[model samples]
Target: LFSAVVAPFLLASIPMLQPDLQRATLNALLQISAQLPVNQTSAGISVTYPPEDAWLTSRWPLVINMLWSLALVIGLVTAVFAMLVKRWLLAFQQKRDNTLPDDVDGFREQSVGLRKWGVNLIVGLLPLCLHFAIAVFLIGLIPFTWHVSKALGVLVSTLVSVGVFLYGLAALLGHMVVSCPYTAP
Candidate 1:
């Protein structure tokens, strides 16, 4: 979240602070202070970005876009993965609890149970693993996704990978807590 919001704000604010990049703007507070005396109001000073040197017109916009887009994609992927893990866990629990009829032949009953487990395992795993793989794949492709500074690309990708990995580990821990029963020693 910080990387998505604060990082872009940093890009916009840091450059503005640099003397070399200073652009002229009408100070609204100053205008208000002056107007307070006579009620002669300048409709709050508007500090509009020039059409030529607008913030979005610059490379910073692309960089910021890339940063936030990566953050959003990774975030959504993490949610999907956590859900998948939870689904798989629930299926396993269900299979474990299911009981066959006493009158049914053991061989046929065993085969049926095995088939059910197999279907559940495949159903639960396919989407989970596919989404995870795509996320990892896109993280690698981010740099090539746009033309941006190599350093920024590499930096964002590294940060994203680390963040995603830690998020996944946390999800795994959460799965463990939910799937396993607590037993006092």
Candidate 2:
């Protein structure tokens, strides 16, 4: 009963794992910055200053810090979400076994359907959702690369973000495959 009622709710909440929309917005800003010209000085004593690029030539430390922080937060959030899902499933199984009537075949059927549906939905959605997230994070790299100092930080953040997303996806897939009903020969 608990898995039937709660798994869908939990799965629907996966998008909330990425609570900070600021990361996507920052990525958009960086993408826009990539279109502008680089800062350069003309030959001779003359000096030239182009209009400050909104995306490039900004305080990179701040940007890098923000990106790394967002990645870390996202990773933690995903880990928590996975843990909660596992706990919920375990608790539901225990409760169902304890409380279900011995003759209630209909209840068993319904529980099987709910579990199958929830796992199927998660397996179908995980890849699409994480792929979009990774694309957004990668977009933030455009402006970060313009500065040598921020480049390393950006790379680290990007790798961590991608790694966490992949990890979560793998977990979801594993759950689906492992919990799938088996057929007898």
Candidate 3:
């Protein structure tokens, strides 16, 4: 009953809508929108940007792009490595089961682990390489730092280098701890 009355009222009012009321409502909406935000698309969609921080807009995208590319490369490499590992595992299993000849290598495997090859190849090699690279690059800066301020620079550089090394070592240890549960071929 409520819907029947309200639906007819809405239909009748829509056809007989007052132009003055429509103009006033539109004007109010325009005023509100004008005060809302400057950033928007042509279709009146709102866009947002970092406020009060021009530095973040410039540097964040660069760092994000660098990390994205690194991750992409690492993922591709890991996928390939996983494929190889799957093949090796299949060949190893087949040889053990007497289906594959003992003289053939792992690369000659006909049936690799098709269902979960990607998961099985958890090499944990990329993070290790990145950590070591970061440690080496930071530690290698000690000589340049030594020239800037004799004692303070050397001390700071030494501390930073040691911290980076320990961080990398910890990361390596963590990787090994995680990976030790899974056996490799």
lDDT of each: 0.52, 0.51, 0.48
Candidate 2's clash total is 0
Better of 1 and 2 by TM-score: 2
Candidate 1 off by > 4 Å: 1-56, 101-185
Error of 1 at 166 (Å): 19
Candidate 2's C-alpha runs over 4 A off are 1-66, 96-101, 105-137, 149-185
lDDT of 1 by residue, 60-83 (tens): 545544544555465556556667
Model 2, range 1-185, lDDT digits (tens) per residue? 22233234334433333334665566666666654545555332333334444433345435544443444444445445566666766765776777658847756765786577685465445445444434434444444444435777677667767876776777676666877443211
The full ranking of all candidates by lDDT, starting with the best, is: 1, 2, 3
TM-score of each: 0.30, 0.35, 0.29
List the candidate numbers ranked by TM-score, top first: 2, 1, 3
- List ranges where model 3 is wrong by over 4 Å: 1-53, 99-185
RMSD of 2: 14.3
Better of 1 and 3 by TM-score: 1
Which candidate should be chosen as best, given lDDT against the real structure?
1
User: In TM-score terms, which candidate is top?
Assistant: 2
Question: Model 1 Cα displacement at 84 (Å)?
Answer: 3.6
